[model samples]
Target chain A: NAGVTQTPKFRILKIGQSMTLQCTQDMNHNYMYWYRQDPGMGLKLIYYSVGAGITDKGEVPNGYNVSRSTTEDFPLRLELAAPSQTSVYFCASRGTGPNTGELFFGEGSRLTVL
Target chain B: AQSVAQPEDQVNVAEGNPLTVKCTYSVSGNPYLFWYVQYPNRGLQFLLKYITGDNLVKGSYGFEAEFNKSQTSFHLKKPSALVSDSALYFCAVRGGGSQGNLIFGKGTKLSVKP
Candidate 1:
């Protein structure tokens, strides 16, 4: 089973351009998240959704937006991308249980902004 | 605010040697800690988690982590390292009321050389 699927494994965008990173999970999880990984910064949360039709801003939400219109999909949108936004993006999902803190991640989407 | 720290930026070890990647966390309440590994150009994969019960949590690929609540550390350990185990390892934490959001460490690059 495809646990989590992400689109555009690699992409390049010019400054001020916009694009969307798509994420879908077959695990039927209630929680989904978008994170960006910089060279030495590990991962920073961009946005998250607890369930369908619900979304919230994460620690580093600037220049980005997210929507959760269904349980299986959560997409992150980049508006007027900047050089600082050029990083590897990952989407993750997790279920609610005793060990709910563990996250299953996608293969990642590498974006470069020039 | 909860946070995680992976003290070492890079760890190198010969194959068949025991390996340890140190991690420490700070949280106001009980902490749910996790370890994830990332291969080159890939996404983060859940390695293990420490929620409660046993301080020693065993996980995939012969990797385990010891949770020391008193020291606020959750260090990942492997009895014998393999060349294939080389990757970036991340430590994460979720505190009370985090709503499943995790704070990740800066990550440690482990290279198990042959």
Candidate 2:
């Protein structure tokens, strides 16, 4: 099964540009998340969804927006790209069961803002 | 706020030697901790987790972690390291809540030399 899938494995953007990073999970998970990994820094949460139509901001949600219209999809949108946004982005999903906290992550989407 | 910390930026060890990656957490209530490994250009993979029951939680790749309530630390350990084990390790924590969002540390680079 494709636990989680992210589109556009790598991309290059210019300042003030806008783009969407698409994420999908086929495992029927109830929770989905978006995280960015900067060099020498661990993953920083941007946004997350507990279930369809229920999204919330995470630790570093500035300059980012997310939508979860379906249980299988959670997409992150960047309205205006900046150099600081040039990092590897990861999408993860997990079930709602208390015993099922292990997150299944996508390969990653490397973005470069020049 | 709940958070996790990986004190070391990098850890080096001989291939056959024992290895340890230190992690500490700060939270108000019982903590649900986890360890994940990420290879170059790859996504994070779940190693193990500590919710309750035992303090010594064994995970994939022969890795284990000890949860110390007094110290508020969860240190990952392996008896014998392998060169193939060289990667980035992350420690994460989730507090008591229905929301399944995890707070991750900066990550530690594990370098196993042959």
TM-scores, all candidates, are 0.98, 0.97
Q: What docking class should model 2 receive?
A: high
Assess each model's interface with DockQ, reporting 2 decimals per model. Answer: 0.84, 0.82
Tens digit per residue, CA lDDT, model 2, A1-114: 888999989999999999999999999999899999998888888998999999998889999999999999999999899999999999999987758787889999999999
Candidate 2 Cα errors over 4 Å, as ranges: none
lDDT of 1 by residue, A1-114 (tens): 999999999999999999999999999999999999999998998998999999998889999999999999999999999999999999999899775778899999999999
CAPRI-style docking class of model 1 based on DockQ: high
Q: Candidate 2 lDDT (Cα, whole model)?
A: 0.93
